[model samples]
Target: MAEDIEPLPVPRRIDFDFPDDIDPNWKADDPEFCAMVNGASLTMPYLEPFLIKTVRETARHIDDPRVQEEAKAFNTQEQFHYRAHRRFNELIKAKGYPELAGLEARMEAAYARLSTRSLRTRMAYTAGFEAMTMGVTRWLINNRVQLFGGSDTRVASFILWHFVEEAEHKCVAFDVYQAAYGGSLGGYFARARGVFHGALDVMFNSMRGYKIILRKAGLWGQLRSRLRLARRLGSFAWTVAPYLLRAALPGHTPRREREPQWVHDWIAQYPHAPEGYIPLLDTHSPTMPVPFPSARAATGAAA
Candidate 1:
């Protein structure tokens, strides 16, 4: 664990009351992108609990109070994130995508098998997955305007809030893994292995979700949709490949990762947000400035 680093993730119970009217295609103009994001969201209800349990189990073997405390905070934030996603997912299912029910069940079963791995493997997986997430959080925030610009308030805010918290605790899983293994050579290989194992597993499941949902939408048969989907997939791979490569290095530590200014602004301004909710990003603004309000119904007007 890095003793020199100050501050850890702050768990907020954001009341993401996604309205029944919230659009399935929240991005409106970009249904392909919407499906991609939806696919990722579908994984959360299943993915998060597994991560929470993994960290909880590993904490039993770790003596570092700071690592254990951060793990607890990470679990708390993950709890909020998955529960919120479950709500949004129900809305998704209701919006003529009941086929997604099968997708979620499959994801649940997949994570169950993953949970049966050794403790070191699970923690390594946790660390590796989080390493990928740190880079992804940066990509999503940096391109917030391009990706989420002019999107539904409920959907956009929910996705944005989820990633922001991801960035907040970027170091927790890695720190917990390091504390347990004491940075051995074998541990280095395990951690590196985890980068691929964890990231690939999640990506495989998410891509499945995308395939199923798009097929249901009848877009899967169209050539144009296929090409655009290919392009989107390529773009994401290109953006995050560097992060994965960096994380695979023997000396890689999340403490040294450089985060963009927006993430910094979000962390500093987040505490002032109203109780029980994270506020919506001002999607309309050019820079998407912060000091956000809550995500509840009364605060329905964009933040």
Candidate 2:
């Protein structure tokens, strides 16, 4: 008989408050930068639903009470993230980026196909996706200034808050999958396929978004700008490579270095602190000013 697995500890919910003082001229002044932000913002809706679904589905297989608790917390945090990003996406659309709408439609179709897989497969894929997110989070933390340019405190703060939670919950999905599947070969294969597919999805979508933003800003006039951005991103991808490699290796050791004291201190004083706070949005309908699905209801359905 299979031994019963123990549950992991539940994490706390996180809250995000949009900064009220962002420069209105920021987007128009730098179209290329705006495009990058918009592209990232556009990804929230599609990715959030997947996260919500994965947590909900995996909760059933989590026999351990601690793990189940953590899954619940994870669901809440992901919901907060989804809603916040949706708000950011609204700002992007307001800036005349109509391409984002089409992108959302494409992602919806893609996720609909993915939703048909078995629970085990979905769990494996979620683990893989989380691993990749961990890699990206670390890279962003290390290169925040370059990624956002200097002096844009709001955007920098927003991304940092997101990545910190992403880093904290990095292992939840993988641990949950292993517990449910007994570490079988099929489970590993499913995870690997998920990682590959998720990476490709992000890359293609990001490229299209970047191109659109650049063309709109008339920044496409300089061939060097395009090459420069691509090369920079390529370098950043290399930085994330080691994390992905380690994640793929058997019996990999998880990295849990604490955030620098200065960085932590900086984030601690915000209206929406990032470490352990989970923010509740004022509304849930698609017509809301900041449209998003209900985190509580979505996760509750899984439980």
Q: Cα lDDT of model 2 overall?
A: 0.61
Clashes of each: 0, 12
- Candidate 1 runs further than 4 Å off: 276-278, 291-303
lDDT per residue (tens digit) for residues 261-292 in model 2: 42343333333344454332222222111112
For model 1 the TM-score comes to 0.93
lDDT of 1 by residue, 168-224 (tens): 888899988989984689999999999988888888888888888788888999999
Predicted structure with the largest TM-score when compared to the true one: 1
Ten-residue stretch with the least lDDT total in model 1: 290-299
Misplaced by over 4 Å in model 2 are 1-34, 253-303
